[model samples]
Target: MPKFIVSLQSNADYEAAKQDIEKQGGSIVDDSMKILGMITVQMSDQSASSLKSLNSGIISVEPDQEVTIQVA
Candidate 1:
């Protein structure tokens, strides 16, 4: 399963979004970012695509990536 970052719209229902993700066979990986309206989930690519399209509260479903910073 691939990991993705799901972003919700402001004022969107968090619980509803969580339920929707579960319905799509996705599991919440990290919800610590929920305060920022973002959640990390682990699921298939198809599930991510479906969730993004079917959920109105979802702003985006993007693959999770690592960011690195270099000190100059």
Candidate 2:
């Protein structure tokens, strides 16, 4: 199966979002953050439903930012 790299850029609450991601059935393959409030996340591919849910959750946060999702 193909893979996807979901990157969420925000100064939002990563902890809560991270937890939600797992609960939604996606795994965090890698993640890192910088002091300037930039976060990069790489999550494992999950079911379409799960992926949609995860995206919805992230958008719900309404971070003082936006999310960029890319497939690989």
Point to the candidate with the largest lDDT. 1
lDDT of 1 by residue, 1-72 (tens): 899999999999998999899888999999999899999999999989988687459999999999899999
Error of 2 at 53 (Å): 5.2
RMSD of each: 1.4, 8.7
lDDT, each prediction? 0.92, 0.45
After aligning candidate 2 to the native by TM-score, how far in Å is the CA of 6 from where it should be?
A: 3.3
TM-score, cand. 2 vs. native: 0.42
lDDT string for model 2 (1-72, tens) is 233344344645666666666665545554554333333333444442354455333442211235789999
Clashes of 1: 0
TM-score of 1: 0.90
Tell me the deviation in Å of residue 54 in model 1.
1.7
